[model samples]
Target: MLDKTKRDWWRSVVVYQIYPKSFQDTTGSGTGDLRGIIQRLDYLAQLGIDLIWLSPVFASPQVDNGYDISDYRAIDPMFGSMEDMRELIAQGKKRGIGIMMDLVLNHSSDQHPWFLQASSSRDNPYHDYYVWRDGMPDSPPNDMQAAFGGSAWTWVPQVGQYYFHQFVPQQPDLNWENPALRREIYDMILWWMEQGVEGFRLDVIDQIAKEPDRYITSNGPRLHEFLRELSRETFQKGCLVTVGEAWGADLQRAKQYSAPDGSELSMVFQFEQMMLDQQPGKEKWDLVPLPFVKMKASFARWQQGLHGCGWNSLFLDNHDLPRIVSRWGDDGAYRVQSAKLLATMLHGMQGTPYIYQGEELGMTNVRLPIQDYQDVEIQNFYQKRLGDGYPQEEIMNSIYAKGRDNARTPMQWDDSPNAGFTVGTPWLKVNPNYTAINAQSQLADPDSVFHYYRKLIALRKQYPVFVEGDFALLEAEHPRLFVYRRAWQGEELLVVCNFGGEATPWQLTQEWEDAQVLLSNYPQHPGDLRPWEAKIFYRKNGAAGES
Candidate 1:
């Protein structure tokens, strides 16, 4: 059995994700580069960040942004050279922060050397590096729909076969069944680690072992076996953190993946809570109001399910999702309070929290026209909806609410021409609210959302309750109040948040009446929670005390 006393370093630290293209642009190329990140190390260090999970900067065709990797060993010139990456890693280590690269292994860009050779002819040595099926020029082997909309199989007339792709056709799925391909992937991973990368965030990792012919796209038969083999060859050799993006994972599967036995992964990113705002059994574009009751139940289930064995990755915003403040909280009148409330509730949970770039500044969604959106997924869906005779207004409304580009706007650094992100035109337009919500303004204000998030990060590191505590939900049936308790050893923390725009009365228990106020959005509790108020009270030995 593994020793239970020594905890991993990742459990107590917070992770900040940086989408490179939109973070900062120092080259005036309208795109962010590695030098831009190196220049901002002091800002991240001041934010109490312990790790940075950077999105893909590898050599790519930019079809799916950087996710469509064309070369695994080279850095794209758009971002920078290998020397710039080395400097960023070295600089981050100086500030006690580590780098975690996003690993896209499920597929590679069609322009990749392997794919180019595989499509040249069926007799080539690299013919088996990708998933291909022999069929007529117009027909495919299976009736499967691609994640973006149309057919999953793309006809390759050069080889007289159809290649499978879960995403866009430009990204062909790699054949993991071939040991030679797996060996190549392992070698590339080790090479990056040798360059001083501390960890990896596996993108769409669950689909690597997919059995496409049988319509099995996730958690396939050889999933665990392949994961264990990958772990033994790479992550097990050092104290490295590996998180798999498993959107299809549930509580039971998360336990197996994060069993702490050093077999599969460190943790899994489950999307149960992210789907709560969508209609049941419908696509994400078919939206619905935020299901408060169902959202609470999902959170409690994961918190209690993965308490002792598996771990969870707490996040509400990412490169592929809309900003949480705009999607769930009020981003108009009570933006600051609601943003802090959302952060407090998430940080008080039992997991390692992740803060996406501009999220701490309460960045909101953009209402740009269809032509202004740059994401491939959004463009594909918009065209499909238009072809289906849907009104332009209806399609745009969904885009405004859930489009991936909502989170891809340039970082709002100041009230400059391009929000201080670029000297030239930005790759994507900056949010217009940058005039009121920018890092320059927030850094000067003590009561800003950025400082609130910093305090939350500090609390997680200073208190054991945030890491090893057992979570229990309070007032589970309440519609407007989100209440929970975290207890560890003799320390207890009561976290309450009013998830509405009106003042709500909450009856505080006698055990928490005089508890030390560890943190709160408001100055003091006046027998009622103000609009979007959030408070965290600390107690010890059944009595109030300093925390």
Candidate 2:
């Protein structure tokens, strides 16, 4: 067993994300709840996860699912009661898994008490809790667009003013400039921590400290100052682990946020790798080539930048992203090979690894018709394309290829009805491929993707080189392979992955000749790496003759 004392708990930890609505439905109400999660603790424990980052469970109107929080202190009834959440924390503790709730501090549902009160009258006490402004006569505030599409500003008839919502109109951005509002949010956070919750996964954290300019900029003076105050007063005590959902943060800014100084956050989920498919100067939903060189360069920059300065929350797929096996790997045929390869490439790097709910089973993206799309972002894009005179086939093709809803379908738990997620109807339709790709089938197969994940996670715990070692990318002149080295103390680990579909050959460097094979996706050594084969090697200190 690894020495728990020697490791920074967070550094060696693997977090599993639970999209609450689809995890399990205890009440048979066609929705997964907190009670369902509590009941499923043993299943998660068996998966070797150290932390559970539950997506937003706070009270919401479900406009953007649960990202729009109506009340920071209350659990949504669709999920469960506050008491149910407390019980979940209690049960999760017995299983040795920490729980992190999603903190949507950047905005709140317009139905929230604060927003409701703020909008009721101009003189309401909570008027300043949200950003309210007088319209500039005919022109609106710049050309700033809402992240979910359309204008960022919405007219509030009751207050006779316009309010800013960076996302949907129903989710109004909170005014962090208001000191009282900030205190209220922090107090809520403290209350949850006191109730046995471990920490928070801050949603759209970078947007919390936006400038009046209403554009994408990082580390604004006010933003840094507020974060410093938040850390000094709240997170610096070390009982809580905070990670930020910062989309555009570069390496320098990530270092500042995650530095040991305890200023902002423990780590931030940077989106550079996730944005690999996006084209320059075009809207984000557009599909482009997934260039291996660009992907390698992005990962290398982040790995080198945070070498010793700070840390990153390493992940490939999350609720907001398309399935990794489908987007980054060849489809179901080479799924197992690519899944293991991606795991080797990511888990061997230095950072905290987060596995999305269905990633271990090698789930592919759902193929849905245009009418099946429910995500606000996808809907907005479809509308925009139609308005712009784009052909219906082009619009449908984009949605099919890159829709956010592709990742939100119900979990595939079995080959039974509704993939065993629920006995009755599911909130969203289950993927039709669930019969062949369910977890029950994979769990019984030793060579399945699920087993590979178990091995990958176990290796991280078994070897310190994977969690705390210095990472160095090997110069493999081949375009189809990704190679890197992790070294610490007297231990060294080499990871090589074939990112292509056909067989590829690689020449071992002089430094790699002394290494012995430790693990591999293939059945034999140096055989043809049939599309996405991964191999790990442990280096011997000296020549065998000397020993």
Candidate 3:
């Protein structure tokens, strides 16, 4: 039997996400591999993170950067052998860290064996494994659009039908209605759990129950039923953590998925706050200035909504998003201070905080010419917009602001060539400012962003108030400040942050007048918060269960 205490380990620990392709390269192939991650185990351990959410490393054609899996069980040769993955799991465990694999269950690469067989013949046993519909050659079943671009349906000559794909045509959606397909996916998940994987990060899991005919891609009718079955068959057998990437989940839907009843998932990745900077009813490319008031309201809603009923996953950036420092924080003069401020605001919240690779070093976005971009999403957008008669300058400007390549740049380990990520040529161009922003320099500086993150993570583990406290947003309408209070039994934590580059006037509440400073980005606390300043104050009450 799985120890209940051991299974809940994820709640209090920080998770570090590694984009394998850009983490570190050991084979001189200019691509990071499992062996490269194995070599960096000690660095992660030293940083005090308890989990590593490794992105998809399964065998693939690299069409969507491993999100399109050709084989669920095999490790891609570019990454390394299965043995290397085993070593990573074993080594991580030795350092008191867990491994969480990224599973792409919503779709599979067209090159997958099941898809090949399904598309080959109408009478094939695997035909029902994927979503297919009859359509005329000149027209698809509907006018639905794929996530990347173009039509969502592709005509297969042999089967005389169109297959549904939510992403690029190379990735065909799976049919969850098929019993056999569900059984196969369950068995594959069990196989990995048996191999000692501690958890899973489900990619686009909310889209699995999509109704292609109805043009509904998320929050479909049978989504919960399917998720409950997934839990009963695999995760429920142990204390395994499961996080679903749910872009459509609201406060109520989030409750159903992550309720303490343990029916569906441990938590969910909601994009409500992430979308605050984008134009409403438009794509991410339609950027707008960050709305501080809306952003705080969104954060307050999630924090209060999921306080006791469900859970929340706190994060500022990820592989699919641009660097937070560049997007919201000051990335130039106050880069270090702003990065630490953002971390304080996020980590002080009540959730399992996720740290994306290179975020700890205060990384910023990179600017490259359109032709130099390597991301399929970017390339597709550029072509589609150009064909639509949009100005080339306008399209390129949006790319600079929101391209995925911003976060996929190679991790800067030192000031050496290629940011010390690869001895050979890099798969993506290294950011030009790596010399001053690399990890080597940060590790030696006690007041660097890297060390600040280490302190914040340690504080989370040290205080129970951080885990079980009640969150109340302060100064909810403040233009350039994000302030909140976390209170637990007989204790309170006041977190103050200045989100702008200019000094902001602020004053502490009367109750926290004598609170001790727990952590601060600046050495001295003036009457007003300095540019991008962040501070956390701690107070203790003598009465039991006191507010």
Report lDDT (CA) for all predictions. 0.91, 0.83, 0.93
Task: Pick the lDDT winner.
Answer: 3
Give stretches of model 1 more than 4 Å off: 1-7, 542-547
Please give, for residues 1-547, the per-residue lDDT of candidate 1 as tens digits.
1121333667777889999999999999999999999988999999998889999999999999999999998999999999999999999998988999999999999999999999999999798999999899888999999998889999988989999999999999999999999999998999998998988999999999988889998899999899999988988777788899999998998998898786888898999999989989998999999989889989999999999898989999999899999999999999999999999999999988999999999999999978889998999999999999999999999999999999999999999889999998888888888899999999999999999999998888788889988999998999999899998888898999999899988878886777889999989846778999999988887433432
Q: lDDT ranking from best to worst? A: 3, 1, 2
lDDT of 2 by residue, 200-261 (tens): 89888888876646564345568777888887767665556789988868888899888865
Please, what is the TM-score per model? 0.97, 0.95, 0.98
Record all residue pairs in model 2 with backbone atoms less than 3 Å apart, i.e. clashing: none
Tens digit of lDDT per residue, candidate 3, span 258-323? 998889999999999999888999999999999999999999999999999998999988999999
Error of 1 at 312 (Å): 0.8
- lDDT of model 1, residue 326: 90
* TM-score of decoy 3: 0.98
Error of 3 at 214 (Å): 1.0
Arranged by TM-score with the best first, the candidates are 3, 1, 2
Pick the winner on lDDT between candidates 2 and 3: 3
Model 1, residue 396: C-alpha shift (Å): 0.4
Runs off by more than 4 Å, candidate 3 = 1-7
